[model samples]
Target chain A: MKCPQEFVFAANYLADMARSRSLEFFRGEIGAEVKADTSLVTIADRSVETMMRDAIREWFPDHGIVGEEFPVHNPDAEYQWVLDPIDGTYRFAAGHPQFGTLIALARHRKPILGVIDIPAMDERWSGAHGWPTVHIRQGRRSEVRTRSCTAVKDATVFFCSGIMWRNDPMAVWNGMHGVNRLLDGDSYSYGLLSSGFADVIVDSGMKPWDFMPIVPIIEGAGGRVTDWQGMPLTLDSGIEVVALGDPALLDDVLRRVSAA
Target chain B: MKCPQEFVFAANYLADMARSRSLEFFRGEIGAEVKADTSLVTIADRSVETMMRDAIREWFPDHGIVGEEFPVHNPDAEYQWVLDPIDGTYRFAAGHPQFGTLIALARHRKPILGVIDIPAMDERWSGAHGWPTVHIRQGRRSEVRTRSCTAVKDATVFFCSGIMWRNDPMAVWNGMHGVNRLLDGDSYSYGLLSSGFADVIVDSGMKPWDFMPIVPIIEGAGGRVTDWQGMPLTLDSGIEVVALGDPALLDDVLRRVSAA
Candidate 1:
């Protein structure tokens, strides 16, 4: 299934809007409030999401919208735009540059276009169903693909945070012993994987806005993303997410993850 | 105990030399090798250290030099320079921008002047004895200070990695539950601490070159850095290290770390 060119253009435009709005609050004193879930939220997140949502409605009224800061709209529509206006709000609140805006155009619940925009770093990764993953850094665009690492032992893994895994934490920690495990990076980890700088990313407790935008980018880069049980991610998929730059390592990674 | 003006000037010159050389290999392919200690090293690390060492020797012939890649030179000299040309090799090898060059000038074994140069990000933080810490980004220099957060539970902590603690992992892991713990950033984390972006940084298994350069920067910003046992870090200090943006949190942080 080919992704619509218009959707890709819209995603890039939406990301631009998000980058401009979010930069205003970054590094400045933001009025950050603790959400019900204990995660931090700032006015920047709401403002960026609202700006993107309004643009989406004005340009494509029939398109649905799902954002982190607001209620879902047009849930039953064929084309749905998923937005995490500010992913890694914790990093953002801490004045870290790894936070990004995620935008995905899902066609009938399957993502076909995705964008990961790191505003502070001026880096962005965009991919669609039928196109190669493209990384743009400082306005230089180039195609990128995942590197091959068939064995899990030799892989460089990015595990977001150990505490996020509510289930058997020790098992998960021990499973990554032989590998080079970096315990940082949120959505930026996926972009690194797509660019072949990282081999795997294991994270849990993700939302639709978190995981959906990455599926297309990872798949388009010849990588794979799935639930812990090895199922494709959807709007209704479970939160335990595993992404592998080399698709062949899926079974080996899943085996270790299942043991955890 | 004021830092010598000449030493501060020399340290900044060395950092500039490292920045130009390290940026050449960053985000580009280089021959990376695994050391006997299982840490990764590259030509960039060796080259940057060699370049800095040469400049240090030429500028101050009597000064001693200690670096990660090579053996100590003039180890008994009154003035000694400690260097870690590439502080976060894993991130650098993975094309991540958080890696930095650490430089410190110690007088009679006490670090009086220090610099943390992040070449890829074009950011540097420098501090000296009796001087406020200064941060430079894109040629803009500003004096930075640590924000006050005295409580352990309310602090935003940056723990480098979990697996580095060989003695007891679970205890340390559980010790950080109530705080907002971020598991990334190497030397960059310390810079963020000095700039008031983070509250605490806890890590283990650090050598002199790793911990020396961070002391003055943290201390000058009105923060504290010490061994896990609450002792000031010296050339012979233990590898277990902890830093706090607010000095009032030292007792509380050490209590938790000791329990771990």
Candidate 2:
């Protein structure tokens, strides 16, 4: 499906914000701040998210927006913009280049446009439902696809946070095995899967804003994404979901884990 | 606890070679090459390893060396150089800066020195036994420490690869679910933990060269490195291992997962 012009415009604007802010202090280090939740949040995160939100308000008057920072705005709307601001906040704070900015357009409950922009690493990946996912790194853009790894033994499976599994060890463990490798974090793993470097990503304890944008990118790149029970994931699907290179393997993983 | 001049000389020599070769390629975009094992390796990887091996031979005569690109010479030796050439080949080939070159000095199966030279990321972490592990990022060297996050929920655990869990879904599920969080790749995770950003790192698969260098670095930074069973992870230790900020929590996690 073609992404609406507004969505594309918003994504580009957000990408530019992410890139500019990332370059501003990327080589220069910054101190980290501990949030009320006790997790760390860098100043760049607040700055980046705020910039994106302001641009959104000017561009789309009626569109709802959900972001990691600030209050949730119009969560019940049919058309919404989800922003991670800076998905890899900790990495960014530590001066690692794995961090990025994530923006997505959701119509009703499903993601129709997704953009993952890693400024420090100089990579960008975006896609809309029915359109091929695209990966741009170091100034090159190409269509991306998932690797054809039918079994866990041949595939790489990742969970963004160990706590996601700790939060539900039984489900995480029961569902995955034979995976070729495991990675942590979200946008980057999804990007790797989209670009055929990995095969699966599963985790629990995520928000809608965290998982939504990733869906179209993964699915558009020839992958399947769902909850642990093999159900399609909507924005309301909670934080637990699995994205895999092959639908059949995804089912097998879900079946085994759910049964256990 | 100071690094001997000769050792430093060798490390810098290797680092120079690594940086020169890797920097040239890092300037331009490069694609991934699937190794014989179907694992990802890049052209920069081959170039870096070749340069390092050459430097080792030139700088330190009669010192046997082991690297990713070549077989070990005098595996059972008084002094042997162990090298990964590029530790995160997958990340490097994928254009992720989290990858780096790993070099360690082993004398009779015990690591006496270790260094992680991340040229593309512009950082280096190194330590020898009894010396405090120091982080050298962008030409600045600072001593590193592990954060004292005692509570399980308060801690950030690095679960290196979910694929390990997929291999033994039952075991990994039980093991990982007990941790607070899982980060990707033990090498980088251990580096983070050593520098106080993360608290624990657990992994099921590791080679001696992959893990040995990390041990001194972690222990030197006031942390514990052991088999998942809480046993010290000497070269002879099992592949499964855990590094923790606090011994009590480490024990609790190990017991919980082992029981599961």
Candidate 3:
């Protein structure tokens, strides 16, 4: 957590830019294409990515870029901005407003500043290297801190999507369904976690842009985000990720989801 | 579809009342209790239901009342107002905005007027006999219509909660997961279906209030809501239900989900 205040400010600004552009096409008749990876992609995603990349280059020309809809740019730079213009395209295209624009700044392959903005919902979350995490809605902002979840048996968990169950190792799916309350939440679960409204989230099939911005947000709120194997997330972390509001619940959750 | 305009107007007014009452507690610390059925219940739910019941009794002294939080009133009356003060208590208690207050007026045990009001999101959907289905958001109203789904293989389905899969017949869960795409949504999914944003939603463990209002909304939108066996919904219908935006896909969806 060594990023500067300026970068955090810039990340928030970039997210605002992404939000206005996204709202323009949201809930409208938008066309989409099946990407080479089989994920859904709409012009909205590409348009927002381009808008963000341009702004980042203008603000910090030397910073690298890694985004979901485009090729990585300047990969060797020490500081990088990661973007996911539309994190939940299916929900977005389906006219559900939980889709968000994610922005994260990584230094030396570690995320240091992150912002999660849902324009349709008028909600945003920002966390940085040394800054406290905050959740913003409408015009008000409040600092967010995770609540303690001392027992996996009592913790409420949100599985990002049931599709994740299809992707999760069978044991992981069973363990996730075994939680006290396993709800279905897409990216909205992250914001809930940041606010201490929920305790755990586990999901699979994520890209860097999907997991990067979330790291600082959750970590800033005193939570932990890691691959299911218990490794801290990096630009290269595997997609199967687990986040816990209380670090104490990690061993029990990992053991349950990874049981042989 | 034969309800009078006065009835629809009253339902909408009741919804506005429900919205304001629910918001007073949303995202705020509120106490919750475990009901005899093991479901979460809060003062928010009870307060809204009581408010609606008082208005209904005062407005139509002869009318019946059936709400999730309270016992049935005047069960033998020809006209009954079904209410679910907070349809997704888990989500509402967790600070999620997808929960809704459902109000439906039933005649001869068949629902005729329905309102789904999402208090936190400032969104409401009302459908009534002889009235066009419409979605109202932020003081604006728009007619809602379902889209055609010629094939189940190409349809996007929302399973109300992953918890439903645990409660449903195993074959039903497998059938829902086997759909082309599965997203997690609750009462909000019913609204999505009414708007044609999603094609099918199958859920289990519903009470009269949980499934009643949705029937009019979907039907008015040119969709169909029924038991998993495809029988039309009634005050007496089972807890398991299915809604299809395109009635033509009903056969395929039912056959798949009902397979032994």
**Highest DockQ: which candidate?**
1
lDDT assessment of candidate 3: 0.80
Best by TM-score, which number?
1
Could you tell which candidate, 1 or 2, scores higher by lDDT?
1
Give the range of the ten consecutive residues with the poorest summed lDDT in model 1 chain A.
Answer: A31-40
Candidate 3 lDDT over B82-190, as tens digits, reads 9999887777766777788998999999989889888888888899988899999888899999887778877777766543455333445567554545556578878
What are the runs in model 3 whose C-alpha is more than 4 Å off?
A29-40, A166-179, B31-40, B162-180
* DockQ comparison, 1 vs 2, better candidate: 1
True contacts kept of 3: 0.35
| Candidate closer to the true structure by DockQ (higher is better), 2 or 3 | 3
Error of 1 at B75 (Å): 1.9
Candidate 2 residue-wise lDDT, A167-220, digit = tens: 445455545554443456467877877776666676667777778878888888
Task: Give the range where candidate 3 chain B is weakest over 10 consecutive residues by summed lDDT.
Answer: B31-40
Query: Candidate 1 on B20-112: residue-level lDDT in tens?
Result: 988887766542222111333556788899999899999999999988989999989999999999988877877788888999988889888
Model 3, A22-125: lDDT tens per residue? Answer: 98877655422221112334578888999999999999999899998789999999999999998877777677777889999999999998898988889998
For model 1, the superposed segments whose C-alpha errors exceed 4 Å read A29-40, A162-164, B29-40, B162-164
Q: Largest lDDT belongs to which candidate?
A: 1
Each model's backbone clash number? 0, 22, 0
Clashes of 3: 0
